[model samples]
Target: MRRRFGQSLRVGVAPGALALLKTSRWGGAAPELVGELAFEGGSHPEAIGVALRQLLQGGGCANWPVSIVLADELVRIWQVAPPAGSARLADLEAAAALRFQTLFGEPTGAWKLSAGWDPAQPFLAAALPRNLLALIEQVCAAQRAPIVELVPQFVAGFNQWRAALKAGAWYGLVQQRVLTLGMIDGGAIRAVRATALPEGADLDWLAAHVAREALRLNLAAPARVAVSGHAPAAWSKGATHAPLACHLLGQGQGAGWSDCARLAATGSRP
Candidate 1:
């Protein structure tokens, strides 16, 4: 039988902080707050190791299923094209590796990559440091927890709210001061970029940013941007004349949220 409470644990890992929410899959009640931890430094695996170690040592989290939500900044995400009708998995992997190296100037040996493999069009690829991935898994295992998923927040948001997104709009996920933008056209991703947001940024800023990205990539800009995370209030008002409309998907606050984004959407503090 399933536990009465805390049936699942949703762990959100950002650059310098971690959030833990315990959710009951069988109940409609709000997810419970297990904990939150903040630390200094970038998204180094060592920092993540320390945070997870502390959280799991509480004893309350042991044996519960875990789902890890990685910030977009933690994972290198990019768009990959499979070179026309060649859909062989090997070819796709090679192409993704090359593109990842080109975009990040990092070798692929220390990272593990996964992508939506498709032959007809472009797909998205995500890479996470091998050591970081292993550390998460090992830490959870040591606590007798089974990991259900280790996913990027951007991919998680899209999977949960794809139907609600505008069909032709550029897609973005905003969380932890980062905006992960995905350009989709002809039912395929053309680009995936995660950029840090500047303070006081508003709808005008979003419009200009999208317009500029389109110009840089030489792709026709979408008429709207569908954002699935916490969109500021300014994005929803007084932008009808703007070149691009900011279409907010999912809730901006409260208990209603994708499990992967629950901690972020709530703005929980340590």
Candidate 2:
């Protein structure tokens, strides 16, 4: 019989602000494609596709619940691309279901979809058609509710951390998302606010903004702040502040990835 287990993988795409995730209950080895496979690979989707083709040649099972978020522009571009076997963001739900059935014989749970902006924007769109929403809703039923809104940056940070761990290195993880005060029960994140970042800003500025927002929302200071896709040295150093850890994701399991599963298990949603 197949093992009854679960794993969550986050993908942070390059050349665009897309933080994606795939959480699964099957015990098969994961797809070896590095980062989230949603973006057009930053001026060279063809090159990235070549790399993915080689990776998939090794033959790993694709049974998983996938979630993706990317800049709207990238989605529009890939939608028109007629490359062989290429899938668009709009086709994500069907693709996910097919991948799930092919690998695990059934869908896993709800796919929490979120996005992050390169320069944080005021509005992000959730463009799911009703059919896709129903499919996602079915899969999510077996999982935990997301305590922390699964934003693009956090997913990106998780992906970087996963690659680092697979490569065998210890590195800090950076997540560039808006922070709202969330309750933590026994070290697990819960009931947090989620939002996008502003334009043309750095992690340092983001941290300051989070701190201020926490205060305004009457929430306690974050336990710590970790950043990726940018330098962590830029974050403000002050007493009575969340310990800031920053590093690029390429090797070693970071704090965010280490705790993500527990967070997911705690807040499984349908």
Candidate 3:
């Protein structure tokens, strides 16, 4: 097939599936190629490697530059505060590792840790399984496809559409039955949480859940929670005694590859 759009592929990796989409990108028109492979069990690195290999082969997308979103389920995201008077990159790294261990009860040696590191303030940090990351790298290398970006779903969503958020409204990402929320105040993120959604969950559930999270954290639930992702449209049409409001956040200021700009590309490899 002739290349119509730029050979830009976007991948979404979930525990049960690997989804590939050849986007009509860089403002060019092209035949859309979308494919997915579904399997049982967790995204063990080898399993994911096989699935991705199949997806790429079937889509004939090898050699294409790619961007990927790691599903929230496969990622651990949390906020960590740098110690008082913290000033070095090592200080922030140590803080993030300690916080990760405290929260997840595990050493950071097995996980690849990266974050918006800052010495002056708390920032969100993430962990990706080392083997799983290595598998992704190996597959990308074999295909000679550069990884243009790799990020968690929640991080990518926040990075793209945060400017559209209403002042003081909490931010959320709802996708694939997971809801990740960020409680933001005055330009700093107070907390981040990712939770599983129950079957048929609706606005009432969302409101009560948000309120519960706020109570647990001593936050006042915002009057609105601006959500980005595959949130149900019906959520925007109802009124209830719900404690908070939800509206789908609009399209982002992002154009082209900014859609997945949170993580820098794994540097060029041999």
List the global CA lDDT of all models.
0.76, 0.34, 0.73
Q: Say which candidate scores most in lDDT.
A: 1
TM-score of each: 0.87, 0.30, 0.84
lDDT of 1 by residue, 1-270 (tens): 245664677788887788787666564555666677777766889888877878767636777888888877778888887876685799899999999889889779999998888877788888988999999998898888889888877787777666666778888877756788888787667887778889988988998899889988888888888886766767877658458788776553444444334533332221
Worst 10 residues of 2 by lDDT: 72-81
lDDT of 2: 0.34
Q: Write the per-residue lDDT of candidate 3 for residues 1-270, one digit (tens) a residue.
A: 234545577777877677676655465443243666776666787888888877777777656888888877788999998899998899899999999999999999999999988787778899999988889988888877789888877787788777778888898876656678898876778789888888878888888888898898887778888887656666676744457678776422122322122111111110
Return the lDDT, model 3, position 3.
Answer: 44
After superposition, candidate 2 runs with Cα above 4 Å error: 1-31, 34-130, 133-191, 228-270
Ranking by TM-score: 1, 3, 2
Q: Candidate 3: where is the Cα deviation over 4 Å?
A: 1-7, 28-33, 239-242, 250-270
Which whole-number lDDT from 0 to 100 does residue 65 have in model 1?
83
Span of 10 residues, lowest total lDDT, candidate 3 = 261-270
Best of the candidates, TM-score: 1
Output the worst ten-in-a-row residue range by lDDT, candidate 1: 261-270
